[model samples]
Target: MATSVDKMSTDTQAESIYFLNAGAAQAEQDRLNRQHRLFDDMMQNDLLPPHVASALSALKTPPKILEVATGTAVWLTEVAKTLPLDAEFVGLDYDTTKFPSSLPPNITLRQADMFKPFSGDLLGKFDVVNVRLIIFALKEGQGTDLLLTSVEPPSQAWFRFQDINWRFAKKVGRDMNLPLSMVAYIKEAGCVDCDDKAYPGNSQLYTRGREDWISRTNVHVKALAEQSLRGITSLGGVEGMTTQKEVDELLACFDKEFEDRIVHYLFVRAWGRKPEAD
Candidate 1:
């Protein structure tokens, strides 16, 4: 029998990945709903500053906003609270588990599947639609994400074996984001403005901000390398499809990828608007 982590990672099949869009949103969601308000302000940092802010300042007033895949709905809602009181806000997602009944009146939460063709009354709407990491969410639980970091020597051996297959997937582009498709989908829905950029966040449990981004990211790099190892072992063992040597090769490759980031670290923060007519 597989452990819980093993079960979570293996339980993810293609079909079930349909409803498994919980992305980095998990961290954000937990932050938003945590019993303390500290997480909301624990920026130790900043917001869409410099580049994005320049564009944001040019936007028309009280524009309508849609935050797709609104998990905890905290990020958008909190930001909305600081908006020009009249700004129209909407949060769209399939799961409403934490949808709050009490929120600023201007903020509206809607249950809509953006993947489908939006019609009639709602066809062409929304001024700003901020979709962050929605692609990673497309297929959640797709693999057996075992974490052998804490496992004993034997399981560690299995983890080392699993890293091989994952390396193969990354090489071809299974990790690529569908920028054009998403842009067209929003455009067809009547959003006139669009921009695609990936600024994967740099997080460090004890460190903070641009100054500490590298240290935080170093931790992340290690974590990713470790994950690749565990994932390879668990998935390949059930089928006898991978070897320990291949796993080491993949781990070494991934470790190098992360090591290079130690000196230079940045994140992508992108957004676009729907022309007023839309």
Candidate 2:
């Protein structure tokens, strides 16, 4: 399908001022794919929550799914493998450059900004929609919203890095507490049974027998920090991080901390159902 470009809304430019570089490079794609795996594992490997699965099963025809801000389209492609062959999937992102060259026959990836209203053809066109990790690009009122480091104690690095990120986020007018606001957004959108759940990304690091989980979590998080360095530095660097050298040094410290410590955070999922047509 062809990509669609809508006319710019007055707030469009502000909404599009993402803190990270939206480039499509092999390394970024690899990191995103691995990140998806890590998050999927954290969520107990269920592509859809039980209730969502039940809802889809009730449909008379094969269900259609949409994933927003679908960088690399990894999740859509993975979930497609679990569903019936005829079930359709669509993935949308502001930048389609990172979408994989190959996809399941049932999947289509398109370029479109989520902050803008979707085209008429895409409106109300799917049975289910998925959005993940789009918080960094959101503004204060938007329903969606990370950082870490190692010099000093790992805890210090973790919280300090978060502080710097919060400052940067405030400067850019983006909300840092996306999970807290999601249910409200859902309710405002007139959806029913709105709720959110948080998944801990501990990867079993604190569990004695889960050394493999620890190793994988460490590797995944470090890749996250490495990928974020350029984007953070590009925004003129946060306080105490005004130069690329400073950010690099901090990242090295974070790497050391990740190597020695059990680092984890929360991944939240929110959902609501639109009332059936009268």
Q: What are the per-model C-alpha RMSD values against the true structure?
A: 10.1, 3.6
TM-score, per-candidate, Cα-based = 0.49, 0.87
Best candidate (score: lDDT)? 2
- Runs in model 2 deviating more than 4 A are 1-15, 22-24, 144-153, 206-209
Candidate 1 residues 159-270, lDDT tens each?
A: 4433433343343223233433455555555654555443323333335554455544444445544443444353432234356675566556555444424322233444
lDDT of 2: 0.73
Candidate 2 residue 4 Cα shift, in angstroms, is 10
Q: Supply candidate 1's per-residue lDDT for 120.
A: 58
Q: Give the Cα error of residue 148 in candidate 2, in Å.
A: 11
Candidate 1 lDDT for residue 190: 62
| After superposition, candidate 1 runs with Cα above 4 Å error | 1-28, 31-61, 139-266, 273-278
